[model samples]
Target: MRFFNTEGPNRADDHYSLPPLSRWDLDAILTLIEQKKYFLLHAPRQTGKTTCLLALMDYLNREGRYRAVYANLEGAQAYRENVDAAMAVIVTDIAASARVWLGDTDAPVLAREVLATTPHGSALSLFLAHWCQRIPQPMVLLLDEVDALVGDTLISLLRQLRAGYPQRPDAFPQALILCGVRDLRDYRIHASSEQAPITGGSAFNIKAKSLRLGDFDAEEVATLLHEHTAETGQAFTPEALARVWELTQGQPWLVNALAYEACFEQPEGRDRAQPIGVDLIDRAKETLILNRVTHLDQLTHKLREPRVRRIIEPMLGGTALGEAFEEDREYLVDLGLLRRDGAGGLVIANPIYREVLPRALASGPQDSLPQISPTWLNPDGSLNPDRLLDAFLAFWRQHGEPLLASAPYHEIAPHLVLMAFLHRVINGGGRLERAYAIGRGRMDLCLRDGAVTLGLALKVWRDGRPDPLTEGLTQLDAYLAGLGLDRGWLVIFDRRARQPPIEARTSSHETLSPAGRCIQVVRA
Candidate 1:
């Protein structure tokens, strides 16, 4: 059975996949290749860049217009800055690819000859020149993992390519496409011997264009899910289909991982008679996050980077990122951690990411939390808002300070600490959802525990900032309206300078909002 693939590049015979060429501008690619232009095909780690490149190579070769060979340069990564060793690995890999893809057995022999006669710095260039000279058809090189090399190795590869750019189909490949996770311009390659960083652009300015392989759109997501139904006679309910799109926003890896979890791994999902539903999709999402699967784990790992933290911390706490924004924001967008929304503003890529990021950040604090009774639960098993608020106040007074120290991002420590507490409150039965955005000055959370649901808004009162009470109440009022709840909590963290210790000032009170909605105000 064809299934959603999570481990690696998609293969048509085994995996359910869309046409790779449809992900980007095929005409533009054709134009570049026809013009004998060197360019880049880049995207996030698992957005199917390799799949697209392989497909392009196959398409080009089948047309008999160009002899296209796809080679992965990841083997060179092991050699690091050893330019000579890395060149040997790359040349041999290209030769192997040519033998397999083009049925050309002589390329491997050419590789050994090239390495022996040519200098390490120019071995790749010399090898490519020799291969093109041997081949009758104009050759195209689709080089994957172009960004895998570091320092001098990367510099040498780029420079060699640039040096050979003037030679056409006879002396070098007619066209070359470098594929990796970032654009060539994003690489600030620093050689060990050089005092300053060298940008990839300077090393290889021959790139004519940069093509990004993008995620699937909504229709593509639905088409993939329905493919299973067509094949197995099992269906996804309308709600489940919409839920998948909502949670994933058409991110290819996420879309596949969620479906693979729900349809294959989950015991009940294996029965073709039982259709997939929203509940199952929700469970699948939870499973992916809880299992800390490779994809999610890698996504969270990126959060530790300072460049990532600068934007994410403010997004988590719902405040402006200040002036340190421009280039860093672009970097995040390129990394696929954030995206340009319909309004041209940056947002956490999708809903699932929005949930996973904070939870990952709070995992440290969540682990160190002290034990407490489920005092917030009523006899009937639903949550009691009043009781839950009381428990949180007590928990904050006793352990909040120490727990704050465990949080990874200190700027949003209070938010993480509270999220940690709520995660405990769920006790495996409910979910806590959060919504925060840059420059919003508020973080809204909704807790759904069985029959009970509570809405809460979090705000931080910083040293130079005005009190967030009025702002938070208004925000919570809007939030409650969205959740269709009349009453909710507004918890404001007092981070102002010289503030009293947490225990003495942590308190709550009931108040009426401007909209006359009932709100419990917690000042901690």
Candidate 2:
């Protein structure tokens, strides 16, 4: 039976998938290939770039217009700076793909022979030239994960392609498409022997255009869910369908993984008689996040990168990044970590990601938190806001300092530690939602347990900045009003150079907002 595929390129008969070609401008792509133009196709990992390339190769070969092959150069990554070894593997892989897809053995044999006799720098070019000469039709090559080859290997491959570009359609491949997670121009190839970094554009200036494969649109997402319904007679409730879209924002891997988990993994989900509902979808999303599934984990791992940190730190902390953050912002957007919201401001790509980022950042602190009794729960199992406040006050006074020191993102250490404490308190039976934006100067968190809801706003008083007490109270007032609550907490974190220690400063006092709503002010 066909299922949502999470592993690799989707096969029509084996997986429920959207049409690959429909995801891009097929006419524009064909025009590039027909014009013998070398170009690029890039998108975030697991977004189906490989699937689209495979489909395009199959289409071109079946149409008998071009002898097309899709070659994955990822295997050559192990050779790193060994240009000769990497190129040999890449050339052999391309030849093997050509023979498998086009059923032409002569091309592979001749190409391998040429690689054996050619110099290390010109080996790939000579092999491609020999292979193209043997083929009757013009060759179209899609080199997948081209950027995976680093240092001297990457430089050699790009240079070879450029060296052979002028002889296309007869001597070299008629057209070439390089596919990877980022644009070729974004690559900063560092060779061990070179003192300066070599940009990919300098190596391959012949690129005609860059095409990005996007995530599924709302309709496409719905169509994929509908395919499961059509096949199994089990329907997704309207809310569940919408929830999936909201959580995934049409990210292809996430859409498939969530559906697969809902319909197959959970025992309750496997019951065909039971229709999928929003609650089930929510559970699936929680499972995906907490377990740190491969895709989401891979994304969060990028948080440690300096470039990624510059863009993400400010978004998480609700402050503006430096003036030089534009390139980093664009880089994060290209990696699918950040997206341009309707207002053109950068935000986490989706609701799931919004939740994932902070939680992942706080995971270390959360794990280190000392055990505490559930003093916040009443006899009837409802959370008591006053009791929770007492627990947070005591916990913050005791462990907050050590925990903050352990947080990965230093700028938001206090916030991470607080969220970690709250996450521990609310783990099994409650929900915590976060909202923050660049220049907002605050992070708002809403915690819900059964019928009880609590709103807490967090702000930092950094060096050269005024105390955020008044601003936070006003912000908390609006936030509480939005949540339809008459009370909430405004937490001001003093981060000035000469501020008192956290233990000495940790305290809370009752205050009133400008709108006359009761507010609990926590100075930590």
Candidate 3:
């Protein structure tokens, strides 16, 4: 039976797949190859690029039009210091893959001989030239994880492929597909003895196009799940599917992760036969974020990359960076990190990602902190604005300094703390509605209990001011209007000055608004 493929490549008939090669835009890729165009296929890690390539290789070879071979160069990357060792590894891997594909181990004899005769500096190019001469039919070469190579090794591979580009159909690979996370322009290759970049584009200018393997579409996701249901006689509840769509937004890893967790890791009392629902998905999302695995951590690592931060930081601040947003927003969309919402605004792709992003970016002594439930100020289940604000003030008094001092994402510390506190309070008990976009105004959190709801707008004032109340009131008014609520609370942290020691006392009171909505302030 086929299991969820969280790691490694999926073979042709071994995995329960989305048609084995159903990633959208396959037609365009095949068209590019048929036209004898060399191109690049790029996508973030684990979005099924390898699976797509394997299926494509099968299709081409089965058609008997040309000899196609797909080899991943990642294994050779570890031998960076020795070019000969690296080249030999690449050749050995390629020969092994070629033999499996074409039933002939000697198919690349010319390629091997050229590498043997050419000097170290020019071996790669010479090998490609010789390989083209030996292969009778046109060749299609698919290089996976091509970006793992660094320095001279990477440049040599590109240069060799480029040198043999002119000898298509009769000799060199008719189409070469280079696959990696980012394009060649972003690569900065420095030779061991050289201080400056090795100029990658000069060696690999033959790229006719760059194609990204995108996340699954909504329909594609539904089809994949439905296929499993058809085989196992199980079903995902309609709400569960909607929740999956909402939380994952069709990112493949997330889709598979949520499904696997829901099926195998259900809470002790939950029913197994009934379809999983949205609430269960919400719970699964919480578990995934709180106890992050490697796949999620990898995306969080990109936050430090300027291209990612250029679009993310402003969102955290609730404002947009008009000029600094030069990176392709669509590329972020393709990577499944950001997406255009119904309002056409760019936000973190989905709720699971939204929750994980902040926690992942926050560095220092955090995960060790106890996960404590919020002490509700209201007796009846509804949040008392005055009491909730006071609770935060009290918590911040004791733990704020130490936590913020060690925090890596200090700029967003207050928001993270407040969210973490709120999550503890209402998590699994009631609903907490959170809506934040890049560079808007303030982070809005609505704590709900049946018909009653309490909204709090958390803002940071870096300016040298003792009070942000007046400025916060204006923003809170707009937020309340959007939420259709008459009254809410504002929690403003005065970061410009050192907060008074916990030994001092503070007061909480209700300030009435012109709209008759109640405003409470907790001065800590």
Candidate 4:
């Protein structure tokens, strides 16, 4: 039976799949190859790059114009700056792939002879030169994980590819495509041998164009989900289908993982007689995040990087990104954490990422939280908003100061801590929904449990800013109106110098918004 593929490359017979080549500009790829150009095809990791390269190789070979081979260079990453060692591994991997997939008996033996003769810097160029001599058709080399090579190793590989650029069709490969998580130009290798950083552009100046592989569009996403229905006779409801698209925004691994979880992993979802619904999709998403599935974990792990932080921190804190932070926008987009909106503004890539980022940031403080009674839970188990606020007030009065240090990003520490506290309350049975954007000056949250949805808007009183009490109330009013609520919470974290300690000045008072909604204002 065909199932959603969550790991490695997709297999047509085993997995409900899409044609990999359909995800890119096919005509452009063919044109580049026909013109004997070297280029880059990059996308975020685990987004079917290997699948695409393999499909392209098959297409080229079947057309009988090019003897195409695809090799993943990730294994060579272990050698770091050792150019000879890295090059040997690269040659061996490529030659083995050609032998196994293309049924070529000469590549392996020829590779050994070349390795014995070529030096560190020129080995790949010389190897390709020799291999092209033996093949009748022009060679099209698809090198995957090109960015995995580091330092002098990466430099050497790029230089060698560039060195072979002039010898195409007859001596060198006719067309070479480098595939990786980021574009080749973004690679800034710290060359130990050169005692300086070598930019990828300088090393491989012959690159014709860089084409990025994008996530599946809405229709493609539906095509994949419906494939499961066709195979198993278990269908996804319309809302479930839309939910999946909303949550994943057509990210390949996420789409597959969510569907796989709902259709196969969860016991209730395993019953083919019962159709999947929005609730099941939500559960699958929560499981993927809470369980720290490899794809989400790997992407979130990048959140700790300083470069990533420089781009993401401002968005979380609701402050304008500094002019300098603009440089890392493309990098973050390449990482798949953020995407450009229709208006060209940067936003978290999708709903799933939106939830995961805050949840990930709140994890540290959540773990640090001390034991507290579930005063927020009613006798029947529904959430009690007043009691929930009381619990937060007491917890913050006692532990808020120290727990701030536990937050991973300092600019968003208060937001994280408050979220951490609420997460502890809701972990039993609820959801915390959040919305904050760059330069928005406030973060809106909706806490849902059973039939109750408690709305909130969080603001900060920084060094030179005013008390923010009025602004907080107005923002909370708008947020509550959106949620169709009459009242909610407005939390203003005071960060100015000479502010009173939590024990001394933390307080909550009732106020009315301009719209006359009752707002409970909390200042700490």
List per-prediction Cα lDDT, in the order shown.
0.90, 0.88, 0.71, 0.88
Give the per-residue lDDT of model 4 (tens digit) for 1-524. 98999999999999999988899889989999999998898899888999999999889988998999999899999998888899899989989999987999899998898889877567778888999988999999999998887887888888888788888989999999999888646456666455355563588778888888999998999999999999989999999999999999999999999999999998889999999999999999989988999998988899988878987888988888887355478888887888999999999999899999989999999999999999988898888888888888898999999999999999889999999999888884889998988888988899898899999999989997778888777778888989999999989898888988976778898889989999989987
Q: TM-score of model 1 relative to the true fold?
A: 0.97
TM-scores for every candidate against the unseen true structure: 0.97, 0.97, 0.85, 0.97
lDDT tens digits, residue span 1-524, model 2: 88999999999999998999999899999999989999999999999999999999989988998989889999999998988888888888888887788777886787678777887678888888877887789999999998787888998898899999999989989999999988746456767566367664678888889888999999999999999999999899999999999999999999999999999997889998999999999889988988999999998999998888887888888998766356678788889988888999888899989999999999989988999888988998788999999999889888888888899999999999999988888876888999988888899999988898899999998888788888888888889999999989999888888767778989999988999989999999
TM-score of 4: 0.97
**Model 2 regions lying over 4 Å from their true place:** 186-188, 192-196
The RMSD (Cα, Å) of candidate 2 is: 1.6
- Model 1, range 1-524, lDDT digits (tens) per residue? 99999988889899988888888788988888889999888888888988898899999989998999999999999899998899899999999999999899999999999888888889899999988998989999999998888898998898899898899877899999999887747356866566467664588877788877788889999999988898899999999999999999989999999999999999888989999999999999999989999988989999998878988998888877887557678778877889999999889999989999999999999999998898998998788889999999999999999999999999889999999999999967899999989888888999998888899999888888788888788888899999999999999999888999999989999999989999999999
lDDT of 4: 0.88
Model 3 error, position 317 (Å): 1.9
Error of 2 at 282 (Å): 0.4
Candidate 3 residue pairs in backbone clash = 132-171, 314-439, 315-438, 315-439, 318-439, 318-440, 319-439, 319-440, 320-439, 486-517
- Kindly report which residue pairs in candidate 4 clash with one another: none
Q: Which stretches of candidate 4 lie over 4 Å from their true place?
A: 191-196
